[model samples]
Target: MRKYWFKVEGLMFKERPFCYLKFRHFIMIVVLGCFLLTNGELSSVIEIEARIPQKNDLFSNGKMDSYDSLENRKLLLFIIDFNDFMCLSCLDSFLDFYYCLPSDFQKHLSWGILVFNISEKEGNNNISARIVEKKLRGFVAANNIKFPILIDKFHVFNGLAEEGTVVMVFDWNRKMVKRYVFPLNKGQIEEIFKFLTE
Candidate 1:
């Protein structure tokens, strides 16, 4: 091994023979680390999946409905906490977008609302199924929602994704292709419509 003496600001240092290669390797490692970190974060954001509840207990419009009914069609599901004002507002916005679609375009998609976080005991609020049903019926009647409003009594779909309001788009194969949080913007709506039309 050869030692090369170098001086900087009157301070002397000795460099090893492969010092330049060592510096290059350090730079490469830092760059690779950064790439992996960024890729991981982006993947987490883009690849969120909704775990569909597979029980027969899901209630829709006073009738029991299973998730199998949603198969074989492009489905748009709104997972909402009905108690949240923001979720309610977002639901209203989504309904507006849904109703404004042309008849032919609308026929290509199936929509449903999954109401969660209501029946689960939260602090002092232990809501019963009867009360939950009454409130949901009122909401459906007030909003004139024709699509199925699913009551998740068992919390089957909870903890599958981030809490609060989410819009999940599933293909005919039941693969969740995209998920949008909160309100739908114009671009998001366009993307959803495009996916459904295809």
Candidate 2:
């Protein structure tokens, strides 16, 4: 039974008796806030282009190349937490999935791993940057990972997680198609292959 009024351009307009004007205004504000937060639009998919440092490669003679040059290549990015002792399972899944992929499918897609050690003290050592880089290189050598393994120098995906694994799939057009958090199972690997084939 309460009446509400709003001012527009120095003119006051009365609300209908049946409507809750205050509640309606609040709803409008919330909707507008979301719109503004998303830059007046929202999308189910997002495009992400990672920045690859020029001299950041553990292998390839310390030269890291950008994937931007590959215009028609789909990317499967595996992001891992280097500090987590238990997260090695994610890397194991990556290896299994990679080796099982058909040659034709491998030609169409490129895969890479970027490990991040977010903590100041990696494992039990308060190591310097040089020592950390050496350790990372050793890991790559030990595993004999065929794909590129780069350290997440820029923290591009820090928001995703600071202590886990995240897998991101991007199409040739650089639009993100899907994301999977770890312990990515065999079913998820199959799903990724299906997505790539499609």
Candidate 3:
């Protein structure tokens, strides 16, 4: 009886130690996965968003790349896709964010008010690209926007997304932070600006 009891205790210790190690490994995998996706874009039930994609571009030549977006693991990508830049409310919202951003923000990451265009004229017409660029410039000049404007015409290459100004923030790895369905108020804008720039 004494020998049987000792054998049972020894077996229990060996199995228990293996179980704990296996559980620890499982937890580590989950944590690592979350960490990896933390920096790139993500989708909720409704919208898709990424940061301005300024830093990831690296070239800084005003080239529009919806694919090579910013890898900001911590920063939210404020992608405002204005269907009509002429819209009064949209312009105001854009300006509100523009004026609210910190002046020294460029030092840390790449950022710009991306002005992407989706049109119907179909068939590889690089003209829309140029047109949107001109229109964006015009809009900037007319409104006196301090922030830069980028023409994200990759829809021509890939396909068009939904209409409306969508703002998305990505962390260092392009993971989404949060998105605004309605135009942000002064307080919300300031709060986000403070968090991102600081």
Candidate 4:
């Protein structure tokens, strides 16, 4: 009878390390799921899939090469909202990818960036069209950016001068194929380049 009681207590009350770990992970996943659903804006920014254009025979055309105009060339438009480039984690991702871009591919892509600023209760002109471009050049040079990061003082998302930036990738076909919202890992950049190269 004592053995039976001891077994019951051990099984019922003892902390199992594996089980505890599993329970903690489950709780985290649930909390993350709840957070993603509750906060619509952050959730949208957290994960995004861009629209990829369908490949056609014209994809092999010479218009995709280095000789093409910057506007006609494939473009990677990265819109950045953070005013301070040094302290931002997103800046790290941008620098990593910018440096990783192969020379041959870099010339043809014609990368451009639009820097934006968030506003307080001010009436208008939250982000000076001039300041935004200047900040962009600083980041581009500091990070050894080989591509041009154009300034968009007016944050044109939907409404005029909307905040936050989105990364847009244009294919050789002169179509805006994809827009990357969140910062990406190295593998993601590789895949994007690979898609364009092919």
Candidate 5:
């Protein structure tokens, strides 16, 4: 067997045998492959091909639009049940994250809040769709939200996630990449920022 040597500055270091180096590299590759597989599985909570409704009634601005209209931009849809208090709080945090993004990043991103009110049976009364739309409009106005306010009158997005509030990120090709529930933590936010900047 022959030995290999490496010099760095004034120091000389003995290198491992070729066979040993090959075995080590093989082990490292296996470990890295496993890590990537596991990370990919854990990162994507749900995969969806969400199609935005084209009806003007579905939009708070009363404009008919389709998902095709958002071409060439990554989309971030905040699906929230407006009746839930926790969801409302999460929306505020989401808005904070959105506001902190640089203007250039914001320009490349197409984001909107898909607001829906799930009617719960309270005695003999149930919230009407008209009332829900009115309330959602007020909420958007009070917050001064400039992004599209998608009104889900028929609970179209309610089944997208188990949580009352969810943040779904879609690539430019309209494939859902990530789904986050509740308020986004620092690490999650950082990951999203990385995606947006990419």
Candidate 6:
């Protein structure tokens, strides 16, 4: 190791040969550390086998009905819509990804929206089931969302809370392949697309 001495304000200080390089490296490391520290945990694509939620008849064509009889069938792609209405960022992220999906690709999938924090009326007040159903219909119609919106009253298995939304990808046999929280990154979207195609 080599040392260089420099004087400033009548005081002598010693620095390594590549002091500037070392400083730059230190700053880079610190910036990376801060980025990771602040960004909380990000859900990664994972492989897992699981069963599809059996609770059904929660939604249909923008209407909430009793847990009426529902036929069970193999599902290719299903989104567990555990989206809180207040979490606009998460909902926006999911909508962007969903709307951009290819038309043909969209048809081959079944969809559902699970409302965790229900706010059908103003001032964040709780509303009746009929009112909620009407609001859900208006929301879907207003946003052109072509999917069933299910309330999470039964607490059907979901991974997101009021802070964010979880986007899950499941196979035909009802096994969850990946579950990513929004806002989803490019890599996550790509991974989901690959799974959907394959």
Clashes of each: 0, 0, 26, 1, 0, 1
Question: The CA-based lDDT of model 2 is what?
Answer: 0.55
lDDT of each: 0.56, 0.55, 0.52, 0.54, 0.57, 0.52
Q: Over the stretch 1-198, how does candidate 2's per-residue lDDT look in tens digits?
A: 123233431233233433456667889999988986867532111112233433322223334345555445456676656654345665676556666766533322444444444455444322433454566566656764445444545555556655476767777554557888766677898888776666
Instruction: Give lDDT tens digits, candidate 1, residues 1-198.
Output: 123233441232134536666777999989988996765221111112233433432334545456686565566676656554334664676667767665533332334444545433453333554555666676666765555556565565666435556767778564667787666788988887787766
Model 2: pairs clashing at backbone N, Cα or C within 3 Å:
none
Q: Work out candidate 5's RMSD over C-alphas.
A: 18.3
TM-score of structure candidate 3: 0.47
Candidate 5 runs further than 4 Å off: 1-72, 85-90, 104-108, 111-127, 173-176
User: Which segments of model 6 are wrong by more than 4 Å?
Assistant: 1-83, 104-108, 118-131, 158-163, 172-176
- lDDT tens digits, residue span 1-198, model 6: 123233441232134446666777899989977886887332222112123433342234435444233222222233434344445554787778878776533432445545444445544433443454555565566667654445544344344443456665655433455667777899988887776665
The regions of model 3 sitting more than 4 angstroms off are 1-76, 106-110, 113-124, 156-163, 171-176
167 in model 4: Cα distance from truth in Å? 2.5
Highest-TM-score candidate: 5
Per-residue accuracy of model 3 over 1-198 as CA lDDT, tens digit each: 999998887787677988767777999988877875775222111111223545444335555445445333343334555565657676576566656555533322324444454456654447756765676666666765543344554442122225455455545443436655336776767666655754
Better of 3 and 6 by TM-score: 6
Which has the better lDDT: candidate 3, or candidate 6? 3
Please report the TM-score between candidate 4 and the true structure. Answer: 0.49
RMSD (CA, angstroms), candidate 1: 15.2
Off by over 4 Å in 1: 1-72, 85-90, 102-113, 118-127, 160-163, 173-176
- lDDT per residue for candidate 5 within 1-198, as digits (tens), equals 123232441132124466566777999989988996766221211112234443322233435357666454565677766655334665677667767776633332444445554446532223455565566667666765545555565455668745756777776554547887767789989888776667
Predicted structure 1, TM vs. truth: 0.50
